[model samples]
Target chain A: MQKLLDYGPLLLGGAVTTICLAVLSLLLATLLGGWGARAKLLRPRGDPLNKGLIRLQARVATAYTTLARGIPDLVLMLILYFGGQRALNWVTELAGLDTLEFSKFLAGTLAIGLLYGAYLTETFRGAWLAVAKGQGEAAEALGLRGLRAFRLVLFPQFVRHALPGYGNVWQVLVKSTAVVSVIGLEDLVGLANDVGKSQRDPFLFMLVVIVVYLGITSVSGWGFNRLERYYSRGMR
Target chain B: MRFDLVFEHWDLFARGVVTTLELVALSLAVGFCIALPCGLALARGHRSARLIRAYVYVFRGTPLLVQTYLFYYGLGVTLGQYDWVRDSLFWPFLRDAWWIALLVFSLNSGAYATEIIRGAVITIPRGELEAARALGLSDRQVDFLVLIPSALRRALPQYGNEVVFMLHGSVVAGVITIQDIFGVTQTFRARYYVAYEGFLTAAALYMAITFVIVLIFRQLEKRYLAHLGLSR
Candidate 1:
């Protein structure tokens, strides 16, 4: 009751952490996913000699996506948090440098970003494919090429198509941020858990956390819908 | 990296995998039972819709781990007051970490399954329902004989996703001392300080189970839903 109210400032800060993690993870996922999709679609410049490099890109991206998507989110978080930190320690030991303590926020963000990147790969790839072939051909006829063609003709349209799936990924990503609590990140869930346990009102505190998440999701969903409409204005 | 360590702990890993599967299976089964009626009620869209909506909102909106903590820590304290609950034979099992994990996981998943089933039932072809009624079936008979089966079939694929999600979500059982893979992995990692080997083994098992779940769903989809050829 009154004890829980005392936790308002701490819980508010934790909410900020949750939102920050979600936003940063989403950004990283977008970057990785864009690269992954391009890698998946990478073909030679119509030269047999270029095929090897293209094949390698495609293979590397496929492996990354498969491993990221296949592993459970928690397992991935643990692997990166523990094993990745261990590897860093080993390297530092060998190099005679200071041993490192892994920051949970960084590790958690990277793990989620990597995992969701695999999902967004398919999303972006689907969006890309859904684009009209004529658009690309028209870009070529207009003397636009490579990055210019993509920026002008392809990226905008595909981004719009990617919005719906991207929204889904973002929502799931937001929820997955709670899993980051395992690493001792003071996200919303972590704060609720600590305060709940201390106050002996775990259910009441968690109920409040649930309401907070519902609010976040509702607002975000509304925002995404508005953005989607903005991007989709002329289409249909 | 440490094959010897992994081999030394074979029983631990095996038990972990078995329990993980059991947790997911039991929860998914029980959740579906709760979900079916809730879904049907929600899809009917009348007096009961608001109740089902609140259930789904609370469960789906919240993360599963907090709910697990509430069940194990919060309810664990509150329910200790009831002598009847404490004295029952079921209390022995209920006190087990496995049962507690199953209870929270089931309820959280039940909420999700409600939505999935609701969506599926809501989209049932109106023509089929009219034909069933025309054949002189009672409303209850039509629901049981025609609607539920079709809804289950339609919901199967999404339900498979839920099953796998539950599989992944069950990892949170580790927080409450449940002996699932994640829990075992944590114990192994802590005991040996060999994070790489312990987590890698568990990750492989998780990925393998995910593949198997996907394969199972694909076969089910083929067998039960080949009629919707082009849409798939």
Candidate 2:
């Protein structure tokens, strides 16, 4: 019991790192996903002559998301961390420059962000499809264009549609932070492991760790549910 | 670049694949056992949703790596306190490396599978339920005769995803010193210092299994879900 108290601060600190990592990855993933989905969605459908550029972009996005589903997340992370470092070193050496040290944080963030981008591409694509077509026509008729139409007409409805899947992906992303510890990131799992090892009481420590994760996911779940409700206001 | 590194260590990789297969098969089998009854309860019986929800939340909320460690080291400490357990026939099995991995993987898959099963059962046709009851079938008989069979078929596609997921999740067995395929890949990487090739070998091996499982599930879906006319 006393040992739990002793380890609390360190675990909390680690939790902070995990949260920050997840948030950064989440932002990168959402942005990339948005772009990827747009590229896939904006293709010159039913037009053979005008299809060159968008077709290539759509092909690349499709390939990325498809391969991601085929491969495990861990494999992708390992490849990026290990292979990327070597590639970076080779480039630096060719430039006659000092070797660049790869930060675990950056590696982890990029790996997870890239992986989730594939996942969220699918999610955003589905949500985009779910938005009623009439709404877009209505927005255009009202002279709403670019970001304003998206914000006023499409965004709220698509956000509502995306909420359930986003909540799912968020939970998955939170759990995935635990794996970043494998690459030597000082996250919550890493801290829990060190404390558990030193105290010689892994059971209690693991139970606490489980509780920590459960708390994060549950609280986030509640928050997403609230957001969903807010977006769904006045709709049946 | 060193294809020979993987080739020279083919035996190690083979053993890793075997161990990985063993883990995947055993865990899915065991998890199916747990998921079946629990899913039925979640679907039909007056079970406490809170209890079932808590179990799924805890397992699904946390990473499999932490869960593995909790079983491998944490549960071992608690089990060490029991002399009778040590004296029993189950002791040697408990001491085996595969035991804890098996246990944790089963529980992990069980939680996910239970959700799949529950979802399938919940979405079973109300007309079917009425037909079963109107034919004077008991609630238990309705589940056994009509509900579960259809749910199993419906659950197949999601369960295929779970199988691939469990295959990937079992890579953490290396953390517990089980020397599974991922473990062998790590060992190969350490020895050769071939970062990309080492992880790629593991990835290819995993993808092959995933590909095969997906094919089998596709066939199963064709046979079972032909009525739906939605081919994924």
Candidate 3:
């Protein structure tokens, strides 16, 4: 326990990795979710040439989300850790590259993004649906079609509506980075575990783990509240 | 690429899925039993209720994985002297992976379910209780006849959500080397190095299982809420 602080560099590295992974994944998932919701709402029916395309997209999205949400995050992390490396190895072999690396950091980001993207998709979709129908119709009636209509009316309303739920989802995702630690990602929990193993003081390291998570959650909460207020302006 | 792999391994998969289902079902059932009573007791505002609330908050606030590790590793060190608890005649039964997994999951689920039940209990209409009281019924009798039943019904939808969540959550049992579906799938992946096939199959199976659970809940909701159709 006394020597635990000697590994401060490693602990800082873990925190950086954890925060970066969580933030990047949140950004990517939100963007993907926004696009997915838009496609679901605005896309027209499919033709004989593209039979079942819409249903397929919807099912894929459903499957993505269900799989992500249903399985424990630890299990998801295991699959990504082992499976991602294996797949990358296969690809590298085919390209005749002797050694191409797939960093655990990148794998963690991609896995969390793809998994939580399913959840964000549903949140974004619900938000989109909650946007009042009259606002969109009025935008169209005012000859504000295409990008202008979405920019002036729909997008802002969607963000405002989605912010609260999205904030909750982000909190869940941030906590989920703890799962990546099981796969040997040097996140706070992972570093804590290492520190514990080396010092033989599991409780103290676990406490550090808890404090790190609390710190991250508190900061993100402040950021989320600020965002919520900013988006929620100009409303009664 | 080989369909024969599944045919050859059909028994293993079936056994795994059944074990997984049992794990989920037993935990959910036990958890609900503990949760419903605790929730009711906590809502009663007795002197002991504050302690129960603290228990519920700590359990519900932390992630399930953290709880699982705390029970397994943390307890293993501090409480290792209680070897007879897992031993004796019970050791053969309790030492098994499935049962211990069920125990951890049941406790976790019970904590979450407490909140759901507590919320439902608070929402029971006061008018019905007053009517029962006017009939000269005892307080206990009025509660048994009026309060508990309606509160449980109101709590059903949220309870259904928790059920689905637990069903999915049971996959973590695999982490402790339970031969559940997820564990068996990982073994196949490791053995054959067919990462895609193994995970894709596992993912699809998980999706199918969750879909079925959601479908059953939806039907239950429709049946139970039919009385409120006009309001709906």
Highest DockQ among the candidates is held by which one?
2
* Model 3 superposed RMSD (Cα): 4.4
Model 1 lDDT per residue over A21-72, tens place: 9999999999999999999987667677688888888899999987786687
Could you tell which candidate, 2 or 3, scores higher by lDDT? 2
Q: Which stretches of candidate 3 lie over 4 Å from their true place?
A: A1-3, A7-9, A43-99, A138-153, A218-236, B1-11, B37-53, B81-100, B119-148, B187-197, B230-232
lDDT of 2 by residue, A187-216 (tens): 888888877888888888888888888889
Q: Residue A163 of model 1: what lDDT?
A: 97
Model 1 chain B TM at 0.92
Poorest stretch of ten by lDDT in candidate 3 chain B: B72-81
Candidate 3 is scored at a TM of: 0.79
Q: Native-contact recovery for every candidate? A: 0.65, 0.66, 0.18
Q: Model-by-model lDDT, in order?
A: 0.87, 0.86, 0.74
DockQ of 2: 0.68
Q: Across residues B106-133, which tens digit of lDDT does each residue of candidate 2 receive?
A: 9999999989999999988899889999
Q: What is the TM-score of chain A alone in each candidate?
A: 0.93, 0.92, 0.89
**Would you estimate the TM-scores of all the predictions?**
0.90, 0.94, 0.79
